[model samples]
Target: MDQNSAVWLLLVTALVLANLPFIMVNRLFLMIKVESKSFIVNMIEFLTYFGITGIFAYLLEKKVMGHVAPQGWEFYTIVFFMFMIFAFPGFIYRYNLRNYLHKA
Candidate 1:
């Protein structure tokens, strides 16, 4: 794939993956019932998604850019925030969203 296409693919993948924890925790969009997960479990799942996405992003960087750039703390901070942003939809679903949909 072209660099541009690859970049878009990575971004979309990251967004989906980042929200997975919230989905699984809230038992949203599942075919079978899952027990509600505790806050600690949810947080762990969030961090796990972060790590997996980080690795995937790094690999994409290496493949598309031909080198892995040295990242500082700032890089990690930005990525964390981005992951949080991506998780917003799932958060809404777990909290405010379901309420609204049911009342609709």
Candidate 2:
């Protein structure tokens, strides 16, 4: 694949993978018929999954990138904002009506 297509594939992959826990947790809750939960709880679970994956990537950075330097608070600040962006789909899934349209 071309570089642009490859990068887009990676982004789509990341977003799907990053959102899986939120999806699965909500699915499991639905399976058991749980009602009324906080959005932050789902977001936190999603972030926990993303954070674990980040830790694994950091550990492998030496093999992948040759050198993985410690990042500053600014880097984390950027990542925190990025995580919010990443979580947008899940927020919409939970709050928006488009999900119902798919089933109709």
Candidate 3:
């Protein structure tokens, strides 16, 4: 795939993955149904998604460049914040919009 395509793919993947935890609270990894998800559970799921996105990005980078590039703490910190930003929509929906969703 081209660099542009790969970049977009990574971005979309990260966005979707980041939101999955908030969107699907009934089950973990589509299994192990729980009555309710606590904040700690959501955080664990969020971090899990982050790790998965990181792996996907690493593979994409390796495929595009034929090697993995070394990154510093700054790079990781920025990426984590970006993932947090992408999760905003889901967070809002889960916390704010979900109540209205059922009432309407």
lDDT of each structure? 0.79, 0.62, 0.92
Model 2, poorest ten-residue lDDT window? 25-34
lDDT by residue for model 3 (1-104), tens: 99999999999999999899898979886678999898789889999999999999998999998999799999999999999999999999988899898999
Q: How accurate is candidate 1 locally (lDDT)?
A: 0.79
Lowest summed lDDT across 10 adjacent residues in model 1 is found at 25-34
Native RMSD of candidate 3 (Å): 1.2
- RMSD to truth, every model: 2.9, 4.8, 1.2
Q: Which of the two candidates, 1 or 3, achieves a greater TM-score against the reference?
A: 3
Clashes of 3: 0
Candidate 2 C-alpha error for residue 86, in Å: 1.5
Residue-wise C-alpha lDDT for candidate 2, range 1-104, written one tens digit per residue = 35465446545655765666455543532354345445676666676766765665565555455678889999888766776677677667666644686778
Question: What's the true lDDT of residue 93 in model 1?
Answer: 81
lDDT of 2 at 70: 82
Candidate 1 regions with alpha-carbon error over 4 angstroms: 26-33, 100-104
Candidate 2 has which clashing residue pairs, if any? Answer: none
Backbone collisions counted per model: 0, 0, 0
